[model samples]
Target: MSLARRHREYIQSLTAASAPAMDGGLAPAAAFDAAAGHAPSPAGTISTAAHTINLRLQHDLRRLKEIRSVANKIAVKQELIGEYDAWVAGLLEAGRTAPRGTLAPTGADEVLPTIMVWAIDTGDWRYALALAGHVLRHDVALPARYQRDAATLIVEEVAEAALRAQAANNAFPLDVLEQVEALVDGVDMHDEVRAKLLKAIGTELARGVDAADAGDARRLASAAIDRLTAAQTLHDRVGVKTQIKGLEKALAALPAPEPTDPNTTAAPPQT
Candidate 1:
């Protein structure tokens, strides 16, 4: 279903408008009234609707924290991602309709970036990359609890996931890794994190060597070696030395290209 439509439905599922207001307590009816009363301004102001959404977001965040504290398994946390899907979709809808460059601070500012992380945890690469584009383009700030900036978080998180997938013999898309590299291009991050990215890319490239033709195998091996070597240079302990050596050996095993005859004359173009 469309996110915008889902958002409207989700909001309707909250407390009814006729509910009596509570003193210094959450008043869903008042929140709804405020949302209906105030339209978002063009000057990056947080609308009443966004404020109301933030209240719900805070409750979800608290629940998430409680779950995370007791949950030790990655699988358990991955399963919890679905619970936040509607809220994430709502944030995306709001952001899409906001004026250009109007991404101001809000109580729910952490929602989208946090969902991006969850997307990666669940192996939802397309969703993660889509959120990455929005976060980077709008310059969204991550919550204070996070130690890294958006670019660093994205690079490190995706790189780590790719490396883990490789270790487990799972199929991680090479184009997804390449797209990530392009997304964070020119953004400075830790050398080791960058090295990990290169390692993932090079390893994925090397995987095709067995099925490629002789010439293609040579080309792939060369490219892999270049990337792995650069990764090694960035971090001596990046764990790519063995991989680099393997690619180098593969490239050495390829037969040299046959040279053209120096004395051959060019044929005239066919009529």
Candidate 2:
């Protein structure tokens, strides 16, 4: 199904569900409407109706979680990255819409693992970066290990793509570079993949050193310095310096700052 269609159906199922009439006996029409919160009435048991809705929501979310592997493959084959994004987004919406009291941390909660697996297995960095950012931004707390592992996979996959492109002496695609840079900005790092990530980031930055757009030099230098600093922390600076030096030279060539008017002195330190 198209992601949008599937999503509409999912939403329909969620919003349209009503608690089974107590013990299979039908609830009074007015009571039922009131219980479902479709109307205000004094006779309905709102608490019972709410619990029923939460249970149904929990069930559907679990089902979605179960089907995630299938969804993952479908997403990749059809280039349905947006669907994957929507599915995760839907999970969040479900939490608020139906309101589960205590979600087990396993179902939609752990979908990032599968998404990260797809990214690494298919060597799809774009999808991987989206998953990384989604998890980092998510209001639901994923397990610490999943967070760590997702970061590792995101870096490794980006570096893998960057290195492959580098082998041909071609720049990494700008989109890929930007996504990886965003991941680096948000995800926590592990030393195991630190140098690899730095290499990719630094190489992309270094490309600006000789760019026709001379304006890119300082930007590249600033970017590289940031990564180089992180690499130093990881104790994984194997290939960082060369890129840093190259970027430093590019910054050196930037036109000297416009003469600051002695009249335009730096703003006094903010109070």
| Candidate maximizing TM-score | 1
The worst-scoring run of ten residues by lDDT in candidate 1 lies at 15-24
lDDT of 2: 0.54
Per-residue CA lDDT of model 2 for 152-229, tens digit only, reads: 666676777787788688777666766765656755666757667776776777666666354566666677777766
TM-score of each: 0.73, 0.51
Window of ten residues with lowest summed lDDT in model 2: 22-31
RMSD value for candidate 1: 7.7
Clashes of each: 0, 0
What shift in Å separates residue 100 of candidate 1 from its native position after superposition? 7.6
* Cα lDDT for residue 159, candidate 1: 90
lDDT of 2 at 75: 52
Error of 1 at 152 (Å): 0.8
